[model samples]
Target chain A: EPEVTQTPSHQVTQMGQEVILRCVPISNHLYFYWYRQILGQKVEFLVSFYNNEISEKSEIFDDQFSVERPDGSNFTLKIRSTKLEDSAMYFCASSEAGTGHGYTFGSGTRLTVV
Target chain B: AQSVTQLDSQVPVFEEAPVELRCNYSSSVSVYLFWYVQYPNQGLQLLLKYLSGSTLVESINGFEAEFNKSQTSFHLRKPSVHISDTAEYFCAVGAAGGYNKLIFGAGTRLAVHP
Candidate 1:
């Protein structure tokens, strides 16, 4: 089956450094999303993208965070000056339709800020 | 906003035994329900989903979930499980409208032993 692909299975960075996470959603998918899971916690929605712009975002998605569909196929999340609390597993997901349908998720990038 | 609650943190059962993972959600509007499974070090995979029509949905792996509107529940079940079924299962809720973000539960870990 087709899948969403994410680069950098793990990343470790200084607390104040900038980090960019990349994802290639399924070829036919129209909606993209980013979610994060802190250790032993519930998965939290960060942002949703469609038609090359952000459709919605959660409170956790603040000024420090930004998402872009840099190219036609690649979706990227950039965190400027990451904080220690930013350490978590970031998952990229895509769906052909919307919430009424199921989503396909990438393995996830484990971001660890020191 | 929608919220999902997984009552059990962990459930241990021997191979060939039956199991159920409880899930409930609170939502003001119509919602879509889904169950996802995540194996160790892997991405989340859709187990099943309830969008419309029948309240019960089933996956190819013998897992099933019934969406109960009145009770606000979507509990996952399996009549017989295998060792390979061990994983963390998450229940999620999303708005019925197109392109809505998902709200996920903390997750329930199922450990199927031989």
Candidate 2:
């Protein structure tokens, strides 16, 4: 079965540096999403994307966070300036028909900011 | 907003033993329920989901979940589990209406021992 793929399985960056997490969702899927989980915490929704625009975002997705579909296949989450709290496992997911359909998730990128 | 709660942080069961992971949600309106499994250092994988209909949904694997509207619960069950079933499980909820966004639980870590 086809699955989502993410690059840089682990990322380590300085606290003030900028970082981008990349994901290649399933080829035929139309909707994409980003979620984050702090160590031992529940996964939190960051943002949802469709048609190259953000459909919805959570309070955690503040000024520092931005998502872009730079290419037809790549969906990315960029943090302008990373904070210690930004360290978490960032997951990318996609669904074929809509949200009603179950989502397929990538292995996730573990971001560690020091 | 929708939220999910997983009561147990960890569960240890012997091989071939039955297991149940409880989940509850708080939502004023109807919602979709889901169970996801995560292997160590990996991403979330869809195990099962409850959208509508029979109120009982199952995965290709032997796992199943029953959606209880009044109790606002969707508990996952497996008649017997294998050592390979050891993983972290998460329960999630999404509003059933348009713009459905997912909210996840803290997760339950299942340890299958010989």
Best by DockQ: 1
Candidate 1 residue lDDT tens string, A53-95: 8999999999999999988899999999999999999999999
lDDT of 1 by residue, B1-114 (tens): 889999999999999999999999999999999999999999999989999999989999999999998999999999999999999999999999788899999999999999
Return the lDDT, model 1, position A102: 79
Candidate 1 Cα deviation (angstroms), residue B12: 1.0
Candidate 1 docking band: high
- If scored against the real structure, what TM-score would every candidate get? 0.98, 0.97
Per-candidate clashes, comma-separated? 0, 0
Clash pairs detected, candidate 2: none
Go through the candidates in order and give each one's C-alpha lDDT: 0.95, 0.92
Candidate 2 per-residue C-alpha lDDT over B21-77 given as tens digits, one digit per residue, 9 for 90 to 100: 999999988888889999988889989888889988989989999999889899999
Clashing residue pairs, backbone N/CA/C < 3 A, model 1: none
Give the Å shift of residue B61 in candidate 2. 1.5
